[model samples]
Target: MVKRCSWGTCNSDTRYPERIINVSFLPFPKPKTNYDACLRWIKACGRPVEQLNVNKITRDTYVCSKHFVGGFPSEKNPDPFPATGGQIYEARVKSRKRKYVELEHNSAEPSCSVPEVPCIDHVNPIILSRNENDKDTQTDEIVYTNLDLVAHNLSIKNLEEEKNALIKQNEDLKMQLASCVEQDFKLKSKRSPAKKHKQVVNNKKFSAETVANSNIKKLFEYYTGLTYVRFILLVNFLFPEEGINPVNYKEKRKEVKAMLLTDQLFLVLCRLRNGLHIKDLAYRFNIKPQSVSVIFKSVIHYMYLKLGYLSYWPHRDTIIQNMPQQYKQEFPTCLAIIDCTELKTEKPSSLKSQSQCYSDYKSSTTLKSLVVTDPRGSVIFVSDLFSGSISDNEICKESGFYKLLQQLKDQGYLQDNDGIMADKGFRIEKDLGELNLRLNIPPFASTATQMSSGDVALTRKIAAHRIHIERSINQIKNFKIVNRRIPGTLFYNINEIWTVCSLLTNFQDTLVKM
Candidate 1:
């Protein structure tokens, strides 16, 4: 039997060593051991899976070294395949070398074009030619310029300048005339008895003025995710100086066509709460799309800082005081419920980023964040967003939540017997032990065919309390920006936006009843 290269269109065979020199045949990987690598190799062979069988691979099945980088596969490139058929390593290198050799061989000789006779009517022009070698003799010719042609060219340039000047002057006069007409019209309108033209309001335009004029609380809530009174409070908190008179406030920097800072804030909130497109927001705000984007980023950054207090971890006494009746009766020591939530996002163009952001559970690209809520369903702490591929146990450990709990324990805010509630997905009992705190996760049926009766009851009770964290997560996702698939345009500030949404959920109505 002949050992032939299995690569696409490759003719390398052991029987014809003279036809293809310095090439060796490699056997296919065994499916039982390196199954994934073997599949990849078979796919790289460019043969249909139905036509090939890895189980029947014999010594005659192989791939040639010409398909690999560096003319061979090494430890660094054990699973080798050509990126493209035309980009085969050996072939590309040989083609490059052959072209270089042809250039070098051709350059060894010097060649020049024969000179042509100049027409009698026109001035002669100089010709330049250079050769690589020093063997060619060169000649120089005298050239003369046409005076009349040069003068005519200069006159035409002067005429163009004069024409440009006249155009500018005409535009200036037109502007002056229009200004005079506007002044005359204003004077006449003031003197005339004609009823003043009613100022037309654009209902489509969204701003503080529009919301105030509409006086619709639902519209306010729909746009900002906050009622009228709460929205006012939020504005005051974010911009204390301009809180009372944000509509009339003037910015030090020139505003976007005299737009108020409050309007910008309203625009940002509408974008976050409604997931409004940048162009739509621009149209509503009477500004350019770029301006809307800039305002949204700048204001959201400010809001991210202003809203940072919402993520504060409540003191132990505060947590106990706010603990719901259900938690107090069954699990008095329960402090906070924790859970990881994911939001779908656009698939990233990069393969590495796609892998990092993909969630097998969601089966889509997403961003994940850890949400921590007290028993009363108030979001106390929200961690920065992590890649969706991260595991719940890993997120809990790496998100600084455990470390912070340990710090609180050292400070006497968190005690040894106090418990952190979470689902069985969090395998952090050992981690909590290091912090001198207890994990209140429901019992897992690990190593058991079935859970005992007591384990079943405990699981139900824990799940009843754990449901608040889920509700809190739902509240955070109520903001449409984090609820739907986040666009790639917002990926740069996605962490900040996700944090803001999580924190803002603290301002919403409580999820857990007393």
Candidate 2:
């Protein structure tokens, strides 16, 4: 096979040992010039040649030793040069060569445009500008002036004072320049997004084929935490009608860089399911971190809108019919179980927001929500999230849970005697005293340290039945976004994320039997 040097400016045959170096051994520094970078890039990737075994070669296939003095740079001498001591390898020569060529071309012009003067040949001819003088007379006059100055008395102190004044002026100029530089830096920082955008455009990207062409079970679910079938179910449920705007602008738009809808959806899910950071998604999706944010925001909004299918309060009859025999037998009047959970959130910069979101219990900022589910573990209600600072009673009332309960009661879905089981967190004795409702909670003591056997038995029974909602919450958090700290960018929609995830729990093959 005929071989040619891949390095720019090296086109010699590679058959000669003196001309070629083994690329596998030497690690060359990154090319500085565009021409060299292009060649280096293609050469590293290899070209469409060896496959056919025709012995033909691509332009970027080899680097001849001619491009390096001692051959290609390696551990021994990383800064090797060309074989010739004078012409160093990779050193810029175009400007110098151009200058020499221009000088030769301009040689035809008179070396000195001015006519010669008497005894002018003894002086330099190049500086004879406009006048016939060789400019030596000006130097002679300076020498005569210095000699006359020496003949007179010149004060050294005056020279030193003048020098000091000039130095002070220079120092002031430098201070002003430094201040300007500092201000410029602040301005640039304030406008860093554009600079970051340029960096994002260069990140490596891949086609949808990366996921589309792979099996769902092998690694897809590992990364996304959802099986392909379930993911496809979500896509089909919301797509075509509720999907985001298509990335494609025109027919068969080749060279398009925007992610495909499936890929985009998958990328968004991974962020939520795995709690992946924007940068992590950027590298996986082969896009910029900012683009990841853009895709995530657009996709998550649509998914939140599509949450209707995932969770809903089942009608009273539906709940009764699906109610497992164990729940019905144990707690016949038990209507629903309610619990509160806190999801950690990224700290907001606003003092008010941070104070409002800070959770003393969790020692962090969080979003607190109340989840009410039927005995069968199907989520009936996931309240609008309460800021962590809000008390449980306030959340129960402000989230419209009381209103929802009123509707159920008025609609006869919940009877006046049907009870709502809760954890100790609820203090309905004070909040809903006038409603005459049955609120079953674990026994607490302000007086004695011990509980009566009857009270203990009641607590255990109620807990056994209420455990389903706890299970429901656990299942909901399986969708990671809520389980992990909610990213700050999505703090505004923490409620939506919670609702959607909770709703998705209902789709899981009846994890709640009743």
Candidate 3:
């Protein structure tokens, strides 16, 4: 194989495994600059690089003359400066070191405190030595021009670098001094101010507004049994005057603080629909139980006012128009189906309340309501809760539905011929007949007789139609609070719970087609 010598100075085109006659081969060593210039010369002596076993050569690396026998280098022929092993070269370099040392010692005057001197015999360069020597300008000039010119240039270069570095450092120190002076001046000019502050965070750890954004969407239906859209609609319907109006509006009412209109509505619905304790709601809405109670009371009263109009028993004509085919065919002028629903609750500790609330029928302390739905299964009316101990006929009358019917009939909205369909549980036929209104009740078994086939068919038919009120009541009781044993905390305003739940059912998707 052909190989070109790596040295520009020794550009040989000889085949491998053959020696270059005059060049020396040295492996690149641990750093020493004295070996550098020697590697740059062409030579016709010594073993080839392959024999020296330098398998690879990088741009910065070298192998050259001073490592081999005939390639011994001297000061006069210092193109490839002598390697460290040469005794003659070492002596010459040592002599140059002493000369520079003497020059530095003699020149250590006031002007040259930061000394600038020739570098020679780099193994131990002549630094600022204290020993002085005779000053001879001619000798110094001869030594500098001939032997130490490179060393002289090197000294000048180092001195220039030091001088530039010192100048930069001085500029940095001046800048820092100016900045420090400015800071001191500003500090002295500024005056101290009075100490005062206002409360920023609310007293409650979580403000109502915070809870509404984070948990309301995720738990909207679970807590309220209403979607976000339905909840907002309910809020807008009930509390329109409480908020800023969009058109021809004035903000007279103090804007609700912290809690949003939606949050207030959602808060009440969660409690009523879930039958959750005020404290449980407090945790969910991130507020105290007292706040939950206050919000609950306010929302219930608000819903009563807003939703009471839905309980308006429709005129006989309106009912007839909206009645389903089954009712129209079987009992064409049937106004509505009526039933009583029971809500189990805590036994009141007070004798009076317990006596009033206890039901022999359910054998449990319970709340009851008169739930009414049109033939198409839409809730047209829900009475305020009554004691479960109250008889169905009494609840029917005392619920003021009888009075409402009487008023509507007197006002000519209800007709004498129009009637209500109910299960045999309601014995209001005679009472309603006194008002010249009919009550279509399914027949019950007498003591000694069996119901005829036709009578049984009629009862079954009426019972089938009665399922509408059953479904309507079921919907209201779907709120766990109404379905489960009541907590005493809500026993006081249990009427409001029944009223709100009953009214909310009407706002849901139409239960019966018109």
Candidate 4:
């Protein structure tokens, strides 16, 4: 039996035996008389007991004011157990440290009236102090247990799942990006074809009338003889040894007359005389531009080398033999009037090139050529083309015109009886004396004789006679080919054309004046 201590003012309790000492309690009846018997009862009941010593018990009454010994009254002396009634109660105060309490039965409920003892149940198992009041508690239930391990395992699993989900999402995003890139590439590749199709749909075609109006057709007529095939064939017959041949006529072939007529050649001559562009000729003939260019070059080359012979100056002996009787005594050995002229052209592209071809007269690029004509207005000599950058004096010097004069002198053509009439630019009066030739040029009026007199009158007469060559030059220029800008490809061909036209002019003069 357990009892509360009588030290209420002292604050001591018997059930909590460590809290008080020096308090007397009456001895209770022993359950078994001997220690062996007590041990047997303890084993049978399977109950816990507090430690006791036989030496601590007194003979008349073993008193422990702190606690009772058993749950029974003594059979040998049965008076109610009395507490020691001494004011000398020794009180013990409990420490502030936590104490544990055990319930007597599994179903026992806590009471509000009793002072509470705080208890902790750790999830992880731990050893607990035994309670004398608790007899049937299981030992397995007393251990503290850890609660965090299961929570930790679950968190690790969740983290692994989240990682897998993120990896799958990243792969899906990469696939989507790749698809977008592929689509962009395909779109770019398709653009060029679409643009090309649009261009085709928007393109315009040229019309028949517009083609007819193009200069290409005129080019054909100017180049193809228009009808000069017959004259070409005829001249070819006369100069068979000089690389001229009929288009198809051969020996043992009956002299088949040409299917084409001479009127065509005359028409071509008229066109050449007019100097129309090859493209314009092509337009008139309804032919291709290239065809006109080729035909014109071939026919012009043929006529220049073959039928164009009459334009050249007569040989020295021929001139001597054919000199007119009236002038034979005065100027018996005169050859021709020589002059230079400028033909304008389009400006060249480069600045240096522009300088090379520039002429102050037209203030643009030009071709320069020299012409020598007899008193009759027939061209006897012509020089190769030169840039307009050259002056008349430079041209005369570089063209070897003086050399030709020397040659004529050596041949007895420039005897004391002969004289040449030239413009003021010739300045050859003193130079002619060295070559045994005489120069006749118009003289400038002096300050004293500002009004013209005898010498001026004679100079005018000579100039009037020399003016025929200028007229011939004008006639030659009537052909637009010579008057207009010549293409660079046709440069060599233009020289030939010049010779041919000069010869034609002489021929026509002779025919018409005869």
Candidate that scores best on TM-score? 1
Better by TM-score, candidate 3 or 2? 3
lDDT of 1 at 79: 55
Please state the error at residue 51 of candidate 1 in Å.
79
Question: Residue 279, candidate 4: how far off, in angstroms?
Answer: 4.0
RMSD of each: 28.0, 22.9, 17.1, 33.2
**Could you give candidate 2's per-residue lDDT for residues 213-234 as a string of tens digits?**
4655446665565566777776
Error of 1 at 138 (Å): 67
lDDT of 3 by residue, 83-113 (tens): 3222323224334433443233234332322
Shift in Å, residue 437, candidate 1:
0.6
Query: Lowest-lDDT window of 10 residues in candidate 1?
Result: 96-105
1 against 2, candidate with superior lDDT: 1
On the 0 to 100 scale, the lDDT of residue 321 in model 2 is 69
Model 4 lowest lDDT segment of ten: 250-259
Rank by TM-score (best first): 1, 3, 2, 4
Q: What is the lDDT of residue 449 in candidate 4?
A: 58
Query: Candidate 4: TM-score?
Result: 0.46
Clashes of each: 0, 9, 8, 41
Pairwise TM-score winner, candidates 1 and 4: 1
Q: Model 4 over residues 47-85: C-alpha lDDT tens digits? A: 222223332223322233333234232333222222233
- Which residue pairs come into collision in candidate 3? 21-44, 21-45, 22-44, 22-45, 23-45, 38-80, 38-81, 345-486
lDDT of each: 0.74, 0.63, 0.65, 0.55
Q: Which residue segments of model 2 deviate by more than 4 Å?
A: 1-218, 240-258, 308-311, 410-412, 429-437, 445-449
Supply the TM-score for candidate 1: 0.59
Ranking by lDDT: 1, 3, 2, 4
